[model samples]
Target: MAENYVLRTQRLLSKLPFSSWLFGKVISRRAPYFGTITPRITQVIPGKCECLIRKRRGVENHIGTVHVIAIANGLEMAMGTMAEASIPRHLRWIPKGMTLDYTAKAGSDIRCVAEVDQSAWQVGDMPVTVTALDDNDTVVVKGSINLWISEKPSK
Candidate 1:
């Protein structure tokens, strides 16, 4: 029954304009954000994804602005979803490395988007680049996430 439900959900999500909508709905319902840095997955495609987060007092740093780590979380959400959705269900992936660059301050809502060149993707290792932008449409943070993808070894 659970497998059937998963298939149904996947099918429905594929039909929609935004794949992240399903991912966000699922994650939010199962394990909602614990901090003020809540992210909403907006769209997901073969090699790209988008997510958003609203800045709040709870997410402020010492400077009284949106925290850098909070933006990183949003970037991860976007990149991870893109990488995971790229592979087939029979395969699995785990993040291997992440490099982050804080470019600017975030004072309002933020959007994180990620893209992976399909031609550059392989079954072994793939690099997904994610970028977070503030409400003004300026990049605040950038992340390069490495994912290790492979099939479950026979036991």
Candidate 2:
């Protein structure tokens, strides 16, 4: 059976003292765009993932608030992690598209949580919901990422 890289990495890093930092480095190497937001995966399990991104100058907008794109990038990272951990080894997936709504100004560090249902594992389009919350625990952004799931080709 193919190993779930996301789950394997999460398990290995959980034993380290600086797991978050090392996880960020691993992600940065795998997905460079996610590095722009400096996301740290806090939790990962089948069907759910959570990540945190500090509000830094690099992610600031013209008005000094967190840029919308930065939040979106964080959300995408969360969704990708969830998908990677949840999908069966015989299946493959790709993000088809995303829809987002900015409800408030993200004035502080943000946490993005993404989740999916067992029904979403089928071969077809699946919509996964991802929500971003500020330090105060207020929802700042909400979105759904559509992923295309299909059986992996015979090796």
**lDDT tens per residue, model 2, 40-72:** 888888999999989999999999888999999
lDDT of 1 at 145: 88
Worst 10 residues of 1 by lDDT: 1-10
Model 2: CA > 4 A from native = 1-3
TM values, all candidates: 0.77, 0.95
Model 1 agreement with the true structure over 1-155: per-residue lDDT tens digits = 12333334556776777664555666555445512356667776667878788778777888877888878777777776666566565567888988988888888888889898866555788788889888889988887988887886766
Which predicted model would earn the best TM-score?
A: 2
Q: Name the top lDDT candidate.
A: 2
Candidate 1 regions exceeding 4 Å error are 1-25, 29-36
